[model samples]
Target chain A: MGITSRTENQGRTIFINVTERFDFNQHAVFRKLLNDAKDGCEFVVDLTAAEYMDSSALGLLLLLRKKAGNNRVELRYVKPSAIEKVVSASNFSRLFDCKAVSPL
Target chain B: MSDQCNTDGSLNLVFKPVSRRLALVVDDEPINCVIMQSILEKMGFETAIAHDGYEAIEAFELLAPDFVFMDVIMPHMDGREAARCIKSMTSGRFTPIVFLTALDDPEEVHACIEAGGDDYLSKPVDPRLLRTRIYSLERIRSLYQKLSRQHDELLFKIAEEQENEALANRVFLHAVSAHNEPISGLDSYSRPASCFSGDLVLSCRLGQGGIRVMLGDFTGHGLAAAIGALPTSELFHAMTRQGRSIPELLTELNHKLCRILPDDRFMAAVLIDIDPVKGEFCYWSGGMPPFVYKSKDQLIYHSSSGLPLGILENYDFVSEVGSGRLTDIERILLMSDGLLDVRNQEGATFSSCGFKDLMDSWASNDGFFSALDERLDQHCQNRLPDDDVTLVSIDLEKALAVLNVSSDQSADLSPEPEGWEWALASGGGYLLDHSEVITALTDTKYLQDWPAEQAERLQTLFGELYNNAIEHGLFGLDSSLKSTPDGFHLYYEKRQALFDDPPPGQIRIQMTFLPRQQGGCLRLVVQDPGKGYDLTRLSELEQHDDPSRFWGRGMQLVRSLADNLIIHPPGNRVEAELRW
Candidate 1:
């Protein structure tokens, strides 16, 4: 499962809604989302529905940060899945700001 | 005439060239020039002629001959003087010159050679010797050509080997990543050798009890070192899945390596188990470096393994290499010799002392694993390491839960719960080690409160649990054997006999923890394949609560401490549960 889309305006903030599993199988999906980032806005990655993430997926995230370049596109991880412990082990919190979003 | 093989494995040309380059025949007499020219043409070489020594020198420079045949008897200048001048001009270059002389005296012949003539040919030159000399020189040139080609090939091969080694190193890293697919709570970094460095690290679960880590460095490098890794990894993961004891696993490993390893090599390794719930650590080492346990204070405990594998044919490893107790919030440090031997820019070794101090400094401030890795990289000056380096740190704080409760909550809560997860952890006959049993208990949710006191009780419970399962369940020992002194002696002998011929039956121990409205409850059931026990006397004795009841002490002690103890069995199973 994957969420390949741009950030939509949610009231005062613009956030990207992720509604599927992120893995190595979704190479094209991740590549497109990274290429299609809009300019001049803080973006929150809403991971409220993602159930799994592999190392390749994590590696894609790092590549996305590099691709963002001077665009100053800050990625915020919101609502990480309980089953996915890779986030804590890799210590992504130190590299990126994470804020949990309540379940709908 | 045809010539055979030269000394340097080459053949001399038989069919001479028809249009061979011309040679100048220089002499004072026109008659001698004519004779030489006719001979040269017959030998398939073109000829040029000069009458006097002065004319010969002028003609020599204008038309450079491949070789020259000059006569000593000349007008303006002798053959000696002209030869000296020609030799000087062509010094270091391969230009053959033979002297043509009518005089038969030794003195004249010596003078010809001293004047830089390569060889002396009498007034009647031998055509056979001329052909042979040209063939020999050509052979020298061809030999040099072959040598130059081989030299170029050798250089190419070396470069190809280096490129292949780089690619092999990348593949080894991929293999490690595949083995350790998804890691949590830590970021692992490894750098492998291109050719083959036997040093490797694996972090995973050991029997679902706790996180298990293994750091191994084989005897040699390259393909020889990596062969053991395949089998070692297979055994490590297989035993971990079956929940086999490290001692038992080590025994299997030892036997396997002894049979497989070649005469010259062996494996040195370390195995570590860390329980997230109990925050306890257990480890076994086999001739590996001592793993350091770091505390908030400057205290460090070193855990070392016993022996390397394949040393003995039939070896029995002691389950515990060292004391296997660990505290919560502690950091365990593991490393290979690569870290200790890392040389600085000034060529000084980064000794163990330096490593300990570095770790202590970081651990004091509760440094994360990433920070520690970064500090190590900085210390090495960001240069490539000469030897392999691997380090793993497990934070005890993250592994344990520290919470306090008020009186109302404390009163309502019980140490053991009612219905939790029921698991049957059994495998190969090697789980007798106290450390293995402790780790298994600590991994379960029921034993999360594995304080020093609770551990002591668990030690007793395990001893009884194991003995009862082995003796009564597998060996079918009667409880009435303790009734008389004679019976006790006979029972001891019978136990030994049973061990000698051990039975094959599974002992299933199930434990559950349930959080009830009033308090939590605990349930334990140990089932065997044997017939059910006679519980009529035990049920009657439970009402009296006598301290000195001979037949029921084991069950009585369990009943008194536990809120509920029931014996439901035909003859083989025991089910018991305790609340608080």
Candidate 2:
């Protein structure tokens, strides 16, 4: 997967777009992007263009959520498809503000 | 090179030759040949003499002697060449050749050995040396022969064992790999990692016009693990066609597997029963991978809440049942753990998130299975996976068309029965497992004379109607409680607590089997005392776009089964008519 980022809302909200399959292969790029994330900054992961994700990717999200734990930076998910079933089943929705996917 | 012998200038050696030793002597000189033959005979061996190198090979082939005494300097081919030929022809046979040498030079002695002789016997042949060489070589030949015979026996045994294994494989395949009736909507692809697979999908038509599909994966994939599939599928098809409930089926499966499977083995499975006319599905899952039910719009899922089948005793196992109403273009997908465990070159398993995301992509497309298969194919590439990967999809809308609900009539469309009237009233002031009450109706004498198919359909209708009366009419329990995980448990517990008294409304149920002039009719009425239900709610649910809601599932099911569903004022008193 390819990761691209943009800052909006006066640099407080950073939206990261993950394209194609999101898996362990994208760990390097995801880690590089995470380094720029600072406290009090809101991060929105846009998976609208993503097609697939695995538990390893969930593990990566877990890693970021833990890292953002001290920052109080709000981690929001945008346009997640029904793919959020795994996340919901695992109770990750309690940690992140998951936007309901558009009905098919 | 001869260190074991005495190293004196004059050879001093003691030798003892065993009787029955056979020897061949090759010499160019006739007199030498005679003398060699006489010495061999004196040593108790049967002698065969060859005059020259050419004669030696010919005589050796005829004699097959155990030992050879060769003159080093001989005619046509010479002793060295003849010894080389004989050694090469003997293959594994240990025929020791000792060269007869008159020369004292060490180089001449070395040449004889390099040409293939085992040792040098100096000539003007010393009888003592001849005896020493012959006796030692004879002992080795005896041991080699015994070893060769034992090797042959082992080869025969291995062949027999392999034959038995092949026969078993054939028998196992014949037993489990037959599907006579193909269900149109149910499609599956199972690629075994080896000669046999631990994954299986079995389908059967239920007596009540429902279709039962069971997808199972055993503990491991291969020949040994595949043995479990035989018993599991046999029980699934046999019991499902007999109109057994999901829980009852699960109990039998668990009982069989518990006795057969090893402690380390268990089957993770999902069993679904779908009624085509009513478009309602009830499922029970145990330890299988998380599966999803997808419609045109939203996705539905229930937690996998029970232990895998075959791991527990029949009485100890508790399987939670989940119900859903199917919408147009509705489908359910069940996958074995092997599908999720598929790893790429980097050794990362296709995680739960990946499966969900992939399913999401298929939401807008009808080729849900194709996309999944292609993506998995690409992910695996040319390398075969180490586990059996299986994916099964049930096409509900398509199955509805294939599963004809109207086919329950007698094949002859026989004249309708003009039987005697009868009635049975159950659940007067006590709460019961209402489904069990209908199940018991199958054994009634009235239905016993009816065609088995008609009797089963009538029983199914009773089950759906009885359940509705108990939950909504008698107890006034809201259907929405079924949305949560423990909602059914709570609803049943509440029903249990109310044993001391009846529901708020007056409760009455009457089942009448009446004979009409032209046909037969079964009239069933269940009236519960309570404020009447809102008719608007039933109408709204009837036309709602999303069928996944918990409300009005049983009513719609009843409306589909009965010829007439009439609700009186307050919607508390309901009447249903079934005409045959």
Per-model TM against the reference: 0.42, 0.44
What lDDT tens digits, residue by residue, belong to model 1 across residues A1-104? 46745554632233555555665566676666655554434445656677655434555555554454433334434444431334443344433456655555
For model 1 chain A, give the 10-residue run with minimal summed lDDT: A82-91
Instruction: Summing lDDT over every window of 10 consecutive residues in candidate 2 chain B, give the lowest-scoring window.
Output: B402-411
Put down candidate 1 lDDT per residue, B165-209, tens digits, no spaces: 555456556655357634334434444433556676776665444
Candidate 2 residue lDDT tens string, B1-580:
1223343323223223342556888888889889988777765667888878889999889889878889988768899999999999998677889888888779988988998898887778886667667657666667887888888888898676556545535644666557424765678877666545677788887665468888887765454565687888778878887788888899999989878976446677888888754447888877666777786688766666666776546443333787777645367777776777677777666664266667786565457677777777777776677567887887654554332232222323323444332223334343445554554454345566666666666777777766667667767878778767588678778866764465433344555565566456777777665666689987787776467654567778788888998988788778888887
Which regions of candidate 2 deviate over 4 angstroms?
Answer: A1-104, B1-169, B219-227, B262-264, B292-294, B297-304, B314-318, B328-330, B339-386, B404-580
Question: CAPRI verdict on model 1?
Answer: incorrect
Off by over 4 Å in 1: A1-104, B1-176, B193-195, B299-303, B344-346, B352-357, B360-386, B397-580
